[model samples]
Target chain A: MAEKKRELVSGSRLVDENSLKERLIVIFTKWEVILAVLIVFEFILFSNLSPYFLDYFNLMNSTFTFMEKAIMALPMIFIIMSGDIDISIASIIALCSFSMGFASSHEIGAAGIVIIGLLAGLSAGMVNGFLVTSFKMPAIAVTLATQSIFRGISQAILEDQAYTKYPEKFAYFGQGYLGETLIPFELVLFLVLAAIMGFVLHKTQYGRKLYAIGNSKEAARFSGVKVDRARFINFTLMGLFCGISAVLLTSRIGSTRPNIALGWDMEVITLVVLGGVSITGGKGNLFGVLMAIFLLGYLKFGMGLINLSAKVMIITTGLLLIIAVLLPGFLDTVKARRKLRRQQKESGMVEV
Target chain B: MSIPTSIKTITQRRETSLILLIGVLLFGVTMRAPNFVSVTNIERIVNDTSILIMVSIGQFFVILTGGIDLSVASMIGLSGMSAAMINQYNPGMPAGFVLIIGMLIGMVLGMINGAAVAYGKVPPIITTLGTMSIYRGMTFVISRGQWVTAHEMTESYMNLPHGNFLGISNLIWWGIVVSVIMFYFSKYTKRGREIYAIGGNKVAAKFVGVEEKKIHMTIFTLSGILSGIAGVMWTSRFAAAVNETAAGFELQTVAACVIGGVSIAGGSGAVVGVVLGALFLGIINNALPVINLSPFYQMFIQGAIVLVAMLINTLSEKRREQELLKGRQQ
Candidate 1:
């Protein structure tokens, strides 16, 4: 009995806060759970407001709208997780699409066009990776400069002209179905990639290094994390995904314009951040982000059914982002204060 | 402190090299288009750059405190659009009153951002990112997607920025006045020093009794006020205000700050550098038209120039660090 009391007084491991009651609270209060509940709530509300909101086919089709962005968000998770950002992703898309269009116009087959798009995006990403990792410039600065440069290259070449022709079968990636399923090819591709990325993030040492770097770059370096190499790879990964997204987008639209994906950077960043990813880095996960993508996608699709203007959706997104960041921060502060008070009380009793 | 060291310092200064580069640019442009170096063209370029100059100064303050306000373009749009609508509906409203109202609107917007960042602990980028679109959305809502055209505005309102003052446009005069006042404010004020201190090292600055929150408030609000002024100038000069007015303009202001050698990490920027950077951009823009290059090429060239300027800024800073280390070793 005396030994048990002593252990209780000093043993943090023995305290096992994972009791049934605590576990229930933790599971229910998880961000992903909250998002799931919110999505369900959105569904009921939208269905009541609009009759066609519940259709399964329409739901499946809605995935096409965000699958490209969702694909881009996979690598974006790594970028933000490592305390870097690439606002140039949308611009990379414009450049890649332009290159692919150029290749198609040259009578190249679908395979060659796809190769050109990926190469364009890869080289573009490499430039950003090189600028950031080698020059030690801030990620925002390098990306902002490159954002302008990449899009500008396309604008200078295209000059208000658009490329309209693509080789046959090129549209399959964007417009085709999976064998006999109603699922989009892009959607299937996203799911497979997301699963792979999720495993790499949660089941690998590389993932742990990202978290360490995000929490403290200096400390991570001292601990021998390959910080620079990891960051470079994240950027290149973002570029490759952008290429994939560009291929999908160009195929779906069947044309490439200079202004294609003009404001997509904002939308993509919003998705990641709203997915419960911390803008400051070192927090959040894939489950939360995936939920955020679907919730926002469906919310937008439902709003369209009711004929609500895109402006209202913009306002809603802004409010949600602010609330998402603020509510959690507020909760954390309260938790911290309570813990601080308890610590003081325990210390005071010991002194007395 | 010695003569040789002082001379070396002068040579190493960014401003010195920037001035030399400007001279080269001017000479090169003159060689291509002989009339480009003329005084009239120079005046025109400066006038055109006046709006960017004001906006860059505003951006400079926020960046000094290691914060970015991505909503700058949106702020410009809403404020400018608001003032333009007032002029369109009530043509009798004084231009000065419209300008003041525009500034007040911007000040309020900035205050919201400052409060969230300084007190609420929301990251500056996220706060601004959200506001960026929200403000634009609000602009559309208020305007009902209608543009305020030049013909709808009063004669006096249109002339506010274009009115000549002793052969110089009022816009150029406004830029000069703002430059002088800001230079004085930054150099002489304790608040300005606090901005630098906080940016350099937040923990150290807080320990030294600097109020990080208040500085954040001041700088962001100041940026808003400046953007407001620029908004008014833009509408008057361009003679139209639309929902998309000044869209994507935040990039140009930031580009000016970066090219002017403002460290993106913050805490170090000068008004002269910002002004020179704006001027350099302005010259390139004007010269591009004269050289017969399509305006489309302008975007490509501008991006390239900013990249070069960014690289130079980094290289020079690194060189300064090495030189300092060598001196310490000696």
Candidate 2:
């Protein structure tokens, strides 16, 4: 009978733990649900606003527009979550694009072109990471300087030249579709990249280290996590991704200009913030970021379809970014108040 | 008070980064074009220096607060466009009024930014970044994508740049006046020291009863005022204005401040250093045009110089920290 009583207590404790887990999941799932609902609402609203918004071709083009942004946002997630930032990604893209232009001028094949572009991006990223870490500089400052440095290099190489002599097959990566449907190659690439990044960030040890480092670098350092190594690797990864984006962008535009990706850094950063990542670091989820990426991309695309100027689209992006960064803190305050109220009510009843 | 120790201490803490950067820049320019020192070249340097000085002064204030005003350039563009529109609408209006109106509009925008950053609790970088888009968008909206033509602006107004005052362009005089005022304010004023105090330790300053929010707002507004002045100078000198004018001026301004020893980390730097840095940058820019070097090569070299400057600053900072550690150990 005593054994049975002890078993009952353990069973109840298990139940309580299970319920706690369920509660956490329930709260976390709300963000995804809200995002899905938002997307559906946006689609319905846009379709009502514009007759052509529902067109497969228009939507397909919209996917292409957001593809590089979404792809680049992945590494940026790791970068920001690790308590660092790189605003030079756009400039990195320019450098990569310019390198490709140089390669094409030298009659290099596609494979060689890809390698060279990636190498340029990696070197740029490494330099940025090295400077930031070794010199103990802020990531923002380092990247700001590198933005000019990389873009300056690109301008030096390409000047006003537009490179366009690639084979028609090259266009497939940016503009073509899979199985002759309405999807673009860039969209497919975005999906593949997003999945890989999600796995790396959510399912890997290194990913956990990123979270730990962001939470507190000192703690992570004491815990045997290699802080600088992770940062350096992540920056290099960001550059590699940026290089890939350059390849897609060059193919899509069918030309390369020195100013091709000018001012894209802020947009990517905006998306990263809107995805619910704390700019101050330590906390974020990839899924929410993906949701935000699509939400923003589609929202802008929808706005574009309704005849908004590109300028207005940028303004809207800025607003969304501000709201996204601030909203989570507001919600936490609300949650804390509610918890306090409930605790007070319970204590009052017990006293009574 | 041993000689070697004192020498080591002075050497460790001194900001030799800017000095080294200036030396390197002088050497590079001298090598590229030995004749880059002609009177004609000096005049060119003065012309470029005027514009950079205006922007650098504004950038210095924002950087001092441990925040950046990315919208400064956009403000310049917006104000330039507005000032030109006013000139085109009524060529007879006092040029001074047009300049004031443009600057006032800029101050308003900056106030909005400061309000968002200080009261709304938005991060300064993000706030300024947003305002940048807003400012530039407003410029495009107001101008309707039209350029302010040279003919629309009056010859007398355009002549202000070509005109000389005290054997220097009025533009250089504007730079000098603004720099002197700023240097005086930063060095001698109570609010100026408060700016440094807040940057050095915001928590400590707050503990000591520093009004953080007010100072932030003031600095941001001041930055906007300077940017507006720059807009006026830029428009008057170019005799034209467009939404995309001064496209990269914000970066250039920041570059000048950084190269001049203005720390991005904040609480450190001076207006005088920034002015000298601006002159250094201006000389480099002007020399490129005179030497007939590819503007592309000039850009490459300028970027390299900025990198080298940052590197030297980092090294000097490390040396200082090492000396401090050594002192503690001894």
Candidate 3:
């Protein structure tokens, strides 16, 4: 009778173990679920706190506040995922915008000005890529130097002058709304771009290579991954995106200055990291990043409605960044402790 | 053979190239502006760079441990603002006392960062980056977006930087004293050697019984204390304190360390190299205005110099490795 009781208990424990595995898998696979819940929570909290938060027009207009930054964050995801960073993105925007402004001042056509802006950004990225790949320079140091150089050039050229001569139609990219809809054109662009980026990062073989390289560069190289090429392309893509962001930002502001988008690199990086991308690399998804952008965008919007100072908003963002980084590790530790306790209990029961 | 050996030595030691570059720059500036080399002008340059030297010394320690403190500039601003506010409120508070208070505040701030990085397992860059904004925001909150003007500052506070100590300015004397103390500490102390070892190979160092967490906290705290001291000196020298004061100086400090041949990768740097780095930047800054160059050129020149210095360092390091490989083959 005792032997029979032991067999029954052991069988029940097996069932319990299977159920636990399923629960763990669900939790692990649904990382985006947490982010989605947080977004809803934030939406509810903000709308209840401020009267103006629920207005469609106010919400649409608010997207412009961070649309440029969101656009850049798309490419930043890939860069960070590949175990590299491009802090020079903001500076690239400054340089590209300044170039566009210069071209506009010289009576260049709108199309020509746009082309010049894109070319300038591409060239800047190429320089960063070349130095990093050829010389084996640390990406952070290389970009940091280029950031200074690019911004310096803009400062030298502009010298406190604001350029406002862009053609009227150019404003459509930044300020226009979808016809009869409350959606912003820039938001539409962001969504389309995010889809493309998501497909590329999640569905493509190149993306897998990026993860491999990020996890272990030498191992990835030995496995025949073209690490250098991928890194170079990612950086170039970063510059290209920066060019687009510059156009959008300049259009929205209706002017360009050397210091435009100054210190924005930090904000963009915060968004990317908050989106679940690891700073040390090799893990993250675009879905989390999209949710993060909206989370922060609305957070700022809600705060703005309540008349919080910019300094306070910045502090909140910083605190949010720290929390976002710390929370995952905290959760993992908690989960691990629980599992350990469960194992101890199971073993004790088995012995009994 | 002798000439080649001397040349090799000059190139092998990074500081020698920096010193030679400084000499070349001075000669060029003196040629362009005859008064550039005057004792008064030289003294002025030293005075201007005193705060820079102090901050760089702190940054060097953090970087030597393969970590960075991006919040140093913000710490400077906060400490300076705190010092100014204390002076404003008390009016009778001694300058020395206020300085100590400022440093204590900085230490508390640094401890927060150290705890986050060491105990919380956050990367140093991310931790410092987050704190940078938080501290800067705190500065605004403390000052209520107000500036402390020269009129509100005590006479002694203003005199701290300008006051003569022996034959040199008080600021230079402070730099000299700090550098000497740091030099001795880094060279003679077991903790200092452990910092370098940890930077060189973290896992190996840990296996050898180095308490990395404690050392990380200590270095960051040290950096904060030094930044606080620099803050006090900055406010004294300028006789004004504002939330934006010392903005972007963190990058400048890092640049100074890099230019002085302090590897950003860490494990190798010296107090002497860092001081020379500050002096090099100071001379360039002083010479630019005197040479009648556009103020705009200064930013470009500074960026170019940093980039070139890094490139040179990389090339030299590569060559050194190649030589080592060749020696092994033989």
Give TM-scores of chain A for all candidates. 0.91, 0.90, 0.92
TM-score of chain A of 1: 0.91
Over 4 Å off, model 3:
A1-31, B1-11
- Candidate 1 lDDT over B1-330, as tens digits, reads 999989987887777777888899999888888999888888989999999999899898888777888989999998999999989888888998998999998898889888988888888888888889888899998999899998999999999998888989999999999998988888889987888899889999999999998998998898888888888888888999988999999989899999899999988878888988888888888888787888998877888888888998898889878988999999
* Sort order, lDDT high to low: 1, 3, 2
**For model 1 chain B, where is the 10-residue window of minimal lDDT?**
B9-18
**Candidate 3, residues A1-44: lDDT per residue as tens digits?**
25447745754765676787746544553446777887889889
Clashing pairs in 3: none
lDDT of 3 by residue, B1-330 (tens): 699989988677978878888899999999989889999999989888988998999999888887788899999999989998999889898888998998998888888889999988888888988999899999999998999999999998888778886889988998889889988888899988898899888999999999999998988898899889888888888889988988888888988888887777878778888999999999998888889877887777887888887888788888888998999999
What i-RMS does every model get? 0.9, 1.7, 0.9
Look at candidate 3 and tell me the lDDT of residue A207. Answer: 80
Model 1 spans > 4 angstroms off: A1-29, A340-352
Q: Which wins on TM-score, candidate 2 or candidate 3?
A: 3
Docking class of 1: medium
How does chain B score by TM in each prediction?
A: 0.97, 0.91, 0.96
Tell me the lDDT of model 1 at A100.
97
Worst 10 residues of 1 chain A by lDDT: A9-18
